[model samples]
Target: MEKVIEMKGITKVFPGTIANEDVDFDLLKGETHVLLGENGAGKTTLMNILYGLYQPEKGEVYVNGQLAKITNPNDAIKLGIGMVHQHFMLVNNFTVAENIVLGREPKKGLKIDINKAIKDVEEISKKYGFSIDPKAVIENISVGQQQKVEILKALYRGAQILILDEPTAVLTPQEIDELAVIIENLKKEGKSVILITHKLKEVMKMSNRVTIIRRGKVTGIVKTSETNIDQLAELMVGRKVNLVVDKEQAKLGKEILRVENLVAKDSRGLNVVDGVDITVNAGEIVGIAGVDGNGQSEFIEAITGLRKPESGKVVLSGKDIYGKSTREIIDSGLGHIPEDRHKRGLILKYSLFENGILGLQHKKPFSKGIVMDYKAIRKHCKKLIEEFDVRTPSDEVNASALSGGNQQKFIAAREISKDPELLIASQPTRGVDVGAIEYIHKRLVQERDNGKAVLLVSLELDEIMALSDRIAVMYDGKVVDILDRKDATEQKLGILMAGGSLSEAKREVKDVE
Candidate 1:
């Protein structure tokens, strides 16, 4: 196989940080090359340079054995390279076809020809084995399908090199497997690929050659089959990494979070959350398992004081905090890990130190009387960054400078570090890398073992099962059934997820037992 692309000695410097230094990367024709690194490593920076998002201070790029110069995204695309970013770039109101052909639309006489564009996108999708609905609105399609549209867009632009950035971050296990097949198909069809991810399993399973980056330098490059995950971790972090977290069994305590006939609705007055009753005991973890939009949002909102239930009661530590203000609820000792990081978890413009104290800094030991203890706040944030492994150049750096995985860790560290009596963690590990997921899982479970109540809601069933002392399957706004960890099965949970009765669920749960 011939080398399709090569970048050597790439170095990118910011105000006070060298994001990449002497980074070497190569992509073979019709091969999937995986990039592996820790959160703050220079992997993304190197890719950004390749795609023209950054102008490397010193580097040389080769395409098809010929030296190439890519100064902008347009230049990269012109050279048959396309990238699907970590955050999607589709417009909400645009149809799938519209989004796919956004920058390069088919013209009919003077304007975009809608009919021709849809047909072209559909044809390209079929050629790529992507069953995307071209006419469907971007907001109306599944994340997986939207990703296919992104791929189709690249293929439509005649890109021979496809760069997928965390493509499976939001996908289910089934979807991840499906995407792996798609990647294989793309490679078989002679399309070169660059998969940027922190997932060691994917690197070992999918890529031919793997490159490890750490702190702005190339740590090592090796054949996928020649190295184990532990070796890769050491290369990425410069130390022996304990991939698995160790924790003892939990000791379940009295009920700390109690909900009785909770009926909550969105602003549209739709009963998104129907009559639901659930309880979480101190020193226990209760996981809510459901598909997206199955009342998980409403349930969390009602519990976290973001939204008030229309009917029924919510008691936190035996007190009705249902109608309490958001501040009041925080004062009552409930920590919430919201699903949307940008919208709920971070103020990107603020420094990492300040963003760490957004919600709870006013409390004792952080603020005194009328002024904030700024030095104390910085110290606390530094400890959290170290403990949670949040990657950043410094605490003075803006939170937005942190990568997606590190941003998620910041949120998890902030919400979980408090060690509150009751914690509501929704999609707590979303967008985080696999290594960090293991870390966050250990911490959440540790909280449970320490006699704190935890209400965890996640779309990942594996996570729910792994951490939950008890699993509550929610469907159509209610917990269809709650099963013991010892007795729950994926098959039974799937049935209950579709609105089966608890008796039926219990029977299925016992079958697994």
Candidate 2:
């Protein structure tokens, strides 16, 4: 195999931290190589050094086995390196073709050749099998489609070594499978790809070679065929890890959360959650499974008191909580792990200690007569950070500075700390690494075992099957069916999620509940 690029003796430092330390990495000419590490494990720093965002203190870079000095992004691009960030950088008002050919637009006699650019974009889309509509505006397209536009941008700029950073974190499972196929197609066209992700499963299945990094050092590099998931995990963590969640049979008790004829509407007066009824019993987890937009958000919002139901009852602990404020619901023994951490979970600018005590600040040991006790708050955050294994340099750090998984763990630690009777854990492991996913799952199940009622909502069916005692399939503004984990197959659950029937599965859930 021909080496396209080699990063030898790479060392990068920031204020109070060494981001990358004496790292050696290589990318082949036509291979889908993977960068595997836990959150804050120097993966992004190493790639940024490669792409010229950071100047290494002591290192050398090579392009096609020739030494090169990349001082900026433009220099990296000139060396046939293009990177697509986890968040898409595109003008929403611009058309897909326009976004793709923004800088390198085709022009005719001092005028932008709009038609030619569209034609070129369409050709590239078809050639790469990306299936993007060049004329569609970026704001109107799905995340998956917008990603195609980003790839098209790289392709238009004549990039051979493409870097994708956590590209599938926000995509649906079906979309992830489609992305895998597209990657295969890219490889078939002889384009080398470098995927930076923490999901071990994707790395195991997609990459030809995997490089594991931990604590600013290269732990190991192994061929994908020769490395099992366990080996990769151990190398990444510097210790052995159990990939599967371990839990015994749940000893479920009486219903702690009951929903009767739940009807909720969006701002447009559309019935997003219509006539749904469900129950979550003590010491058990009942997961609501669905795609991204099919009433799941509204259902959780209504139940958690973010939005009041149009006409229904969200009975928590035998009391109607439909019209209560979020704070009141929290006071009423509901621990909600919101889906969007930045939007609803925390104030990003605040320190981790402050954010951890936001919802519980008024309680004793956190506050005293409208004055927050700073020492107590710091103590709380420090304890949870150590207990939850959040990979922050310190608990006093700003919440925004942490990585995705660390932010997630911060939220998880706070929610579980509430020690509420009924917990609403929504998408607890989304955007986290596989190791962190296993850890979070263990924590949630431990909560369940402590005799708490857990109402879990997730888009991952595998997660629903793994953790939930019973699964409620939500589709098109209704509770289509609920089923036990023992009898629910992926095939049946998929059909029910798309508004099909799960008759036998429903019978078992009803009997158990």
| TM-scores of the candidates in the order shown | 0.91, 0.91
Q: Which stretches of candidate 1 lie over 4 Å from their true place?
A: 228-231, 238-245, 266-270, 364-370, 494-513
**Cα miss at 239, model 2 (Å)?**
2.4
How many residue pairs of model 1 clash at the backbone? 0
Model 2 worst lDDT window (10 residues): 504-513
- The models' CA-based lDDT, in order, is 0.84, 0.87
RMSD after CA superposition, every candidate: 2.7, 3.6
Cα lDDT of model 1 by residue, 233-329, tens digit: 7787777766654656678788888888989887678998999999999988899998766788888888777888788888888777886888878
Query: In angstroms, how far off is 207's CA in candidate 2?
Result: 0.8
